[model samples]
Target: MFYWFLKWVALGPLLRVVFRPQAEGLENIPTDGPAILASNHLSYADWLFMPLTLPRRVSFVAKAEYFTAPGLKGWFQKTFFSGSGQIPIDRSGANAAEGALISAKGVLGKGELFGIYPEGTRSHDGRLYRGKTGVARLALETGVPVIPVAVVGTDVVAPPGKKFGKVTRPQVRFGKPLDFSRYEGLENDRYILRSVTDEIMYEIMTLSGQEYVDMYATRAKAEAKQAEREAAAEKKAS
Candidate 1:
């Protein structure tokens, strides 16, 4: 209800006019079935442009903080996120991964589309990071095909640490669905999970054309921040 209203009536139209997003290979997404949209996280705009371009509603598992902040700002945040077809899951605890999978599976159970960032977080640099195995686990466990999605130019439109971006069109390319049903029941096998995840990441890398980094996005961000802090401290002592 709110999702439809927000998308068709409010944000979707506004975003289309602003960014002019275009999607390719949208036919690959099943109009009525479960599938995982495995994408490389670039910017916050990645989420917006995806749903704005797709006809069917796509649901993303977002951080719980987006739904639990305080004050009027929190109310707006909660309303926007909820209305945009996002589900909140606490990602701070050790069991966060498990909880997210459960939430995602529930969405799949209803034969709906679910979106996931295989890198687990937005890429701090413009490189494709090694994907986490959660996506593979979800695909294998549910026996659903995984569609590799490449979202381009969103970083330029809405780069990290910025509230607004320049007026530029973004491109969304969808690859064919990847079937890993042959590896069914092997979701618990760590090696198999890594292999499956790497395969999906390979497709996303090909589509996005980002340099493949063999590290997680979160780790890369931390390292970049540390380097910045060290450089600042060194300059201060000079």
Candidate 2:
């Protein structure tokens, strides 16, 4: 399959040579069952580094745009993303979360590892942001244990707005699997979902050791952009 070919034959080897990614707690990942690997989003390289050392195939949901790019460059992009174990799903519209959940559930149903960023988007700053509750819903609905994963130093490998950077080592740490079996039937409860999601984020925070931000990463980015615009307007007026 393309996944194995890309992982073992191409990208995986290249990444090992370039980034020299290191991993700890590999034993925490279930060897032969469905499990959710929930991680903090640091940079685009976060996903790449997480699976570099893992033997089992891991699939992550990517935006639809990555698969729909046109022309030759688009073709390359699509091929690379697909071969890298990314499943494209439209993350827009009212049903975005539902659609993503459905797609992720299918991957898990196949008894494969499903990776998700509970923060929803990459952090503009280095701090960890509040996680969305969708991860909790997925774990509860599928009855899969959530493994808190922390990817460190990837931001240096590929920072935001830059295509690539100098080769640097990044580390991946996997925390123990979290079981929410006691709240099996409470998936529909918003309060319960928030509680479960917060707990997972807490573990990720402890593992990653990044400053905790109560606000979501998307909102923080928007606010930072707004501030930049305001500063530019004031400078132009002066």
Q: Pick the candidate with the highest lDDT.
A: 2
lDDT of 2 by residue, 1-238 (tens): 8888888887788889877899999999988999999999989988888988799989999989999999999999899889888999887888888999999999999999999999999998889999999999999999999999999998998888887866789999999999999999999999999999999999999999999999989999999999999999999999
TM-score of each: 0.96, 0.96
Q: For candidate 1, give the lDDT of residue 112.
A: 92
Candidate 1 error regions (>4 Å): none
Clashing residue pairs, candidate 2?
Answer: none
- Candidate 1 lDDT over residue span 1-238, tens digit each: 9989999998788888877899999999898999999999999889999878888989999999999999999999999999888999998899999999999999999999999999998887789999999999999999999999999999998788887778899999999999998998898999999999999999999998999999988899999999999999999999
Give the Cα error of residue 52 in candidate 1, in Å. 1.0
The TM-score of candidate 1 is 0.96
RMSD of each: 1.2, 1.1
